[model samples]
Target: MTQNCFDDGDEDDVPEWADRVMADVAREVRRRRKEMKWSAQDLADRCEAIGFPIPRNVIANMESGRRAVLPLVEVMVLAEALYTHPIRLIYPVGYVEEVQQLPLTYPVDTAQAMSWFAGLNEDFRADHRMLRHHVAHRTAVERAFFAVHSEERQRRAAESTVDDIEQAKALRTQADLAERTARAKAELYQVRSDIYADGDPLPDLPDELVDVDPPEGYERDTD
Candidate 1:
């Protein structure tokens, strides 16, 4: 329910709150544009290159705080134009330590809000299924991708730096150990992902994981 203000006869706070949020966004957009040496026209051109075609006048209005409400699509295109993640513009994480999560709500830590927005953690009031979904998918993604990707990099580094035989051998051994750990995690991720993939034998995985099958007859002893 909107509380009516006594003097102005305003019944809604959302418009004011929304304008404040957009002011923050405008400040950020202008800062990023200036940092990258882009004028309003340049920023607009980048948006056009991204196929959204936000006109220079629109960019001017947004950056000048004349526009308060931006569509979600504009947020995405602006982030890409500025070479930033959408969430960074959505919530100014480093610029402010806390943010009002919503109008009339107490401020929460920016990191907490970011994590909640990213589906990295559960809200107490969130649906139980979604909570489980985030956890399971996050675990599966990390297990299926992280170690294997790191080890692959290490292996490539080892291959390229073969000038020192002993050093190269040490790096390869480290990579082999990491690969063993990756195999264990990938097997577990497959089990956990069945609920998502409806028991498909080959659950969807990152391309790197697809190419990272354990060598045949290679025992995976982590000891």
Candidate 2:
């Protein structure tokens, strides 16, 4: 005979793995609080300053895992109160080597797990081309931005130095930094072009760099 779906009575229940993950979160919160040398009351007060006002008793219960559910709002507020990224609180990178990501799955490497959570890592990146392109494109953008910014500061230092020897050194370094900046910007352009070819939304290039294309003779870094 066919069975009614509701007769099973398990469909509406929260999974056992969810509670385990919640307990992990609770433990991490307590660890961070202790590391900061703050009582539950102190954490509550900090939350109040941020206008979210989690009570001391509530925080204590949460840390004790008596609060079975943690709202995303509270996660964000607690992260702010603890002066850390929400990702770090959830994944505890550098504090743990692996994380149980799902009910039946084996633990995943902590760093890779965190990257997956952030949509920046995938087990089969080659099969998901946009995500792969995004990772490369993002790294190139950051490198180009920092290279240009560094060259700006170096140029300023070269112009302002009163000592002749220091000024010469600054100018030499600025010239080298400028070459690196050009190379980085060149790479960013090529990555961006590849992203566009893949039909993804155009990367949000910095306004100052929107017009800079790859230099005519420079080979873009493939990796």
Candidate 3:
């Protein structure tokens, strides 16, 4: 006889806190899936595609709280299918605050950390994107300059002379500067991302948190 995937056999052993968390996770999963206009079957198919293999009925059970045990793997796959981070599903605002005083382990969870970052206020998110754009631009410039520098170095080496050595040295210095600049920009963005994601208090913003278009000629290159 085949056992039910939803029946983990320890349903009665789940704590009230865990039950509440699962309920919240269920609501979030259902909400996000609906927001994406995906049916439960669609979600199940997606989970299966990602190798988690949750059945449609299992998803329904999860969303309806008929299933008490929600594995982390399933939550992750579901979150991916719903185009969100697992933290959103597992650690909604209320849940986080409720568990804040407890010795919960979510604070150290990387996925939760990323979800928190992704859920930061508009201003921080905007600033992060801008910093990311700057980093990308600098990195692209560095790569292009490095390629040219490599070619120049090879050509100069073939000539077997030190005539252009100073110029090559200057180019190398510029490349190093560009790399440092990119690293600094990336570090700044990461710091902000981590701070906001960790729910630390942020200072007042210089401006309102409205969404602004990327600066001219420096559009975000997510790729």
Candidate 4:
């Protein structure tokens, strides 16, 4: 179905991939312009001179989705204008159910079409093996990407597990140190209490005590 523009009613029926595919196309087009350092007006003027006559706002709206579902021929023309491969603009990320409707020819040039069809047939038959090889190569690339991503995720999980173990060890060490501190403080308090008892030799010091003594060399060495 050729939709000039998508309406609100058709919003639900628009495949979830529509927005993403449109956005990707727009982004690539924009990126091409940026890479060439061309302003929107510059591109528009060039296209106009070449008989395409695209306006800056038209390009902007298309990219911004105010205009949606650009025709494939227009996309190819844009690719030519941008000096990029048409396939780059049309390559689908995942499964894309796309249909291109070509205008019907009346009083058709059967000879030309037949010639083109013959060439296509020859190409298919001649390059079938090479085409299969490329397809296998693409599948391998996709599988490798998946495997790399999976390995990265597994590595992160392993690192997280190690971190958790380290944190637990640190916590255990802290608890042990705290317990030792409390015990030492309690023992010192007991010593102070004993000193302050009626039959004890000296007065007890405060529970929170700071032992202050001169340097060890303060006392003469007894031989």
Rate residue 38 of model 2 by lDDT.
Answer: 98
Question: Which ranges of candidate 4 are over 4 A from the true structure?
Answer: 1-14, 92-223
**Candidate 3: minimum summed lDDT over ten consecutive residues — where?**
205-214
Write candidate 1's Cα lDDT for 61-164 as tens digits.
Answer: 99887775788889899999999988888677777666655666556777787787777664542655545655565676676566666667777777677579
RMSD of 3: 17.0
**Clash number for every model?**
0, 0, 0, 0
Model 3 TM-score on a 0 to 1 scale: 0.43
User: Could you tell which candidate, 3 or 4, scores higher by lDDT?
Assistant: 3
Candidate topping lDDT: 2
CA RMSD per model (angstroms): 7.3, 7.7, 17.0, 30.0
- Give the Cα-based TM-score of candidate 2 against the true structure: 0.73
Best by TM-score: 2
Worst 10 residues of 4 by lDDT: 99-108
**Best first by lDDT, ranked:** 2, 1, 3, 4
lDDT tens readout by residue for model 3, 107-183: 23334344455655456656675554444444544554454455556555545645587667666665666565455
**For model 1, the run of ten residues with the poorest summed lDDT:** 1-10
Instruction: Extract clashing residue pairs from model 2.
Output: none
